[model samples]
Target: MTASIIEHQDLGTGTEEPVATAAPDLARPLIPNPQSSIPLSTTPQDHHIARMAAVALGLTLIENAIPTPLPGVKPGLANIVTLIVLTRYGWRVAAWVSLLRVLAGSLLFGSFLTPGFFLSLAGAVCSLVVLAFAQHLPTRWFGAVSHSIYAAFAHITGQMLVVYLWLIPHAGITYLIPIFATAALIFGTVNGLIAARFMNSKNEMLIHENNERHEIG
Candidate 1:
């Protein structure tokens, strides 16, 4: 009778132990809850940001489609949009948008794996990095013009570096600098003026709207 009682107790203990272990395992979450998991699809702010990025990208594509007299001379018009994004949304978001623009633009232009695509990629990356750094400066000091100038220079520099290293391995690469510099100045100034005008106009409108809202409220 004593042996039987002990055996019965052992069996009960074993079953209960398995049940307890299995219960905890079942209760565990499949994925850990992260603090950064905001549902962007439903969030109003994210929706607005997405809309802005899309619009900016559209404008960039339009600007890029415009043919220049020179082969490599682009107004860097898309860069103006990127600068605005960096100023408003921060670097990480700007970087993402810039990269997407490059990939999409490459595909759209049907130059996906060409040397030109690589050149554009290098220039775009350099521009974004320069713009990101520029955003940290006081807006009053650098403003739109300086930022555009610096970004344009960086873009040209990056393209030249890629060309010299990979694309054109000739000794005549140095001669191209004068031409790129001149072109950079012209395009950079034009884009800078456009950016400044756009930024200032937007600011004015926002202020006016805020004042009207306050009066109504």
Candidate 2:
């Protein structure tokens, strides 16, 4: 007699349903994607502008922190970066950086849309306009030092105009020009020297790198 052969699955009751297999996990991890390889979309010029703006803003904050003997007697260190950008890049690039610094600095310092911000904006705009003309002057005769002094004067003039027109209308404010001029002269010279030194060093470094590449090739 032949033994009855039956499949294991066939032994199950007809009412029993087949078990479904679990699908593979397609969900991403909850951890942050710190290792993402995507690069920033900003170009080199954008990066340069951003870096300059940041440096200028930082200088602005530092100037704000320093105690001043007078209301408008800060060192204006931020102008150094602006001068550097103007000489190295151009008036347009410098303008962008300067305006960005004013806006970002005002926002960072919690002075946005205030009288202080208006003054800063006016000063920056005037300085940029002056620099646009100044940059066209002979580089040999009008260097960073000259540009700095001119821009400093322009800045102060712009601020004074804004103050006189909007903040405080007073003819006596013109008397303060000598003091502001003195401060601008001193600070502009110092800032110009610093910017010149930095630009010189940067140029040297670039030259060295280029020489190395040439020799390598």
Clashing pairs in 1: none
lDDT of 1 by residue, 74-160 (tens): 777777776666666677767766777777778877988799889988998898888878878897677777877888898999999
Give the alpha carbon lDDT tens digit for every residue of 1-217 in model 2: 0011111122212223332322433473322353664333333465567778888999998888999999978888999989988887778779989999999998898999999999989988988888889889998787888888888889898999999999889999889989998998898888888888787896889999999999999
The parts of candidate 2 lying over 4 Å away from their true place are: 1-41, 202-217
Among all candidates shown, the one with the greatest TM-score = 2
Q: Candidate 2: lDDT of 75?
A: 86
> What's the TM-score of every candidate structure?
0.69, 0.73
Which lDDT values do the candidates have, in the order given?
A: 0.71, 0.79
